[model samples]
Target chain A: GAGVSQSPSNKVTEKGKDVELRCDPISGHTALYWYRQSLGQGLEFLIYFQGNSAPDKSGLPSDRFSAERTGGSVSTLTIQRTQQEDSAVYLCASSLRDSSQPQHFGDGTRLSIL
Target chain B: QQQVKQSPQSLIVQKGGIPIINCAYENTAFDYFPWYQQFPGKGPALLIAIRPDVSEKKEGRFTISFNKSAKQFSLHIMDSQPGDSATYFCAAIKGGSYIPTFGRGTSLIVHP
Candidate 1:
């Protein structure tokens, strides 16, 4: 693909339900990242993946938030037991290698927890 | 902890005017700084970036003025246009880390 792609541009779920957001990074890119943007707020880093190494999950807000990158290409972010506070736009990005390189971003999936 | 702080949550300017957005960071370890521009319903796009080694960088109508000692940086848009109305963000990252600390966005509205 020419750029990072994210699935289900919008997702609306009930409280306590689980939701999964997906991302397809640019081909051959070795770095991927996930971020959450609340309404009128700064982007909050959620996770990062570099090649085959263990992902950095230090930014995950809680135990319910988890993510996985499969085959070093597509990635999934799963939020368990959705809450109203979890409503926000989930963005995915990919870079040539790491943070030192500029990242390309997807339009993002707007998650709404009702 | 908010590592990056942006000023003037919003700004309005006439077309052809120059609008400047500022940011400050607390971490001395951050060596890379970048500015992103985002339109409604769109993902952020990298506008310009600067490293601590240089104090300024310019690309087209965009310019970044960085102050390494004060941990401050600014984005100046020359000859602003209505099409340039968007939200701008500032981000900083350490030399070896991939995680960028982002500042709250500044909404810029350029009136025609």
Candidate 2:
């Protein structure tokens, strides 16, 4: 694709349930990132993938958050036992370079945990 | 810990005015500073970026002013327009790290 793509543009899940969000980065981009945006809050780093694998997962809020990428292209973020606080926009971006270049972003999936 | 701090949570500017938003970071290791513009129900897009080596960078109506000594940076939008009304964010990334720290965005309202 010409740009990053995210699936399930909006999702409403019950509290204590689990949800999954998908992201498909640019064709040749080797670096992918996941970020969360809450109301009145800034973009919060969640995790990053470099060629189908993640090297940094420190930003995940808790053990309930997990992500995986396959074929160095498609990525999925899974949240287990969703909480109301998890309601926010989950954004995905990709860059040609690992960490030094500008990133192209997706429209993002707005998750509303009820 | 929040590495970047942004000021003026919201601003209202008349068309043709220049709206300036400021940001400061505590980390000296940051090498790149970029500003992003976001609209309601949309993701943020990169507006402009500046490196620590450069004091300023300009593109079209947007300009970035950098102060390495103070770890401060600012975005200036010249000739602000109603379409320019959106949320703006300042972000910093260390040279070797892929994760960028973002500051709480500033909402800009360019009234006609």
Candidate 3:
């Protein structure tokens, strides 16, 4: 409600199974971002959405990773045929402006591929 | 290449000690720098930020020292406490770009 919200706080799935992670951004926030964080590693940018412009998917690691922001409010990140390497904490953030503004983050969804 | 480089993957300090985390960047276009703190099982939250125009900024016990010439910046915690233990991240962002480059993060432990 007041902050960026992510669903499925923890998800454990078998390898090769598909999964979808959801993010509900703060009200009136026009920018949303997705990132992957490995154990004791830096955040790897996954995708970015600004207003109505086309999402910047350049940081996606593979074709299996895709995301979409519907109605400019909520977004979902989907991984197809997940592999063990895909196991990581998927973080979501929302900002009033773009990168120039501070982002509010949610307690990310921890996705495990077993 | 990692645009932002952070040092000391892990650190430990006694209560009331000062712990500093360093980060460096190679991008000249980066104008905004921010630090985030994340606790166990939680995402990072913006702690403090400084622009290139200012050399340093202070908020509470957290201080950010920026050196534009060296393209390096550091975060200092004054009188750190056990409650301050967490992972810290340094990020650099350029104007007109939506993507922000983040450092590998530093894990700090303030022991009581």
Candidate 4:
């Protein structure tokens, strides 16, 4: 089966610009999560979506980082006014509704801010 | 406010050697612990997972030793190979929450 898919495997943008990263979770997956991995760092939680419930945005580093899951499927993570420090690999994962279920991850979109 | 803590930021071992990675968590509410392996330019894939009920679980060359009382767990790779070189992450998920707190990754390099 097709696993989680992410668009724009590599993205390069200028500072202060905006960039959008897309993720397509596996079919029938009800839980989606977004994470950021900086150089030599761990995965930083960004946001989470499950079914129709409200998303948990507490992990979002700043207001400039926002994400939206429309129709309970595809998700888009947008970073506004990008900064040099914003450069990192954005990863998306999906899993069954159960919290104990293992999550499947996409290759991720590497965003570079110059 | 990091719930899960991992040690040994990096490790290097011979092809036939065993490499161990450890993780500790403060939250007892966490019921599931999973380890993920990621290679360069690739997403992480689930290596093995264990529940609080079991003290250890082994699949293939990977074994997860979990200590519920001590709130700690470790991944032991038996006879690791150069192909096993990658970044490993440990994560714990609460019973009802969809989010899983991840620990700092361990970069493992096995020389053949």
Best by DockQ: 1
- Which pairs clash in model 1? none
Per-prediction DockQ comes to 0.89, 0.83, 0.87, 0.77
lDDT of 2 at B89: 98
Which parts of model 1 are misplaced by more than 4 Å?
none
lDDT of 4 at A87: 94
TM-score of each: 0.98, 0.97, 0.98, 0.96
Query: What tier of docking accuracy does candidate 2 attain?
Result: high
Could you tell me the lDDT of residue B29 within candidate 2? 89
Worst 10 residues of 2 chain A by lDDT: A47-56
Lowest lDDT 10-mer window, candidate 3 chain A?
A: A97-106
In order, the candidates keep a fraction of the true contacts of 0.80, 0.78, 0.83, 0.76
* Global Cα lDDT for candidate 1: 0.94
Ranking by DockQ: 1, 3, 2, 4
In the range B72-110, model 2's lDDT, one tens digit per residue, is 999999999999999999999998888999999999999
After aligning candidate 2 to the native by TM-score, how far in Å is the CA of A30 from where it should be? 0.8
Q: What is the C-alpha lDDT of each candidate?
A: 0.94, 0.93, 0.95, 0.93
Q: Please write out the lDDT profile of model 2 over residues A6-111, one tens digit for every residue.
A: 9899999899999999999999999999999999999999999887554589999999999988888899999999999999999999999765788889999999
Candidate 4 segments whose C-alpha is farther than 4 A from its true place = none
User: Per-residue CA lDDT of candidate 1, range A1-114, in tens?
Assistant: 788899999999999999999999999999999999998799999999999999999999999999999999999999999999999999999999998888999999999988
lDDT of 3 by residue, A1-114 (tens): 988999999999999999999999999999999999999789999999999999999999999999999999999999999999999999999999797788999999999999
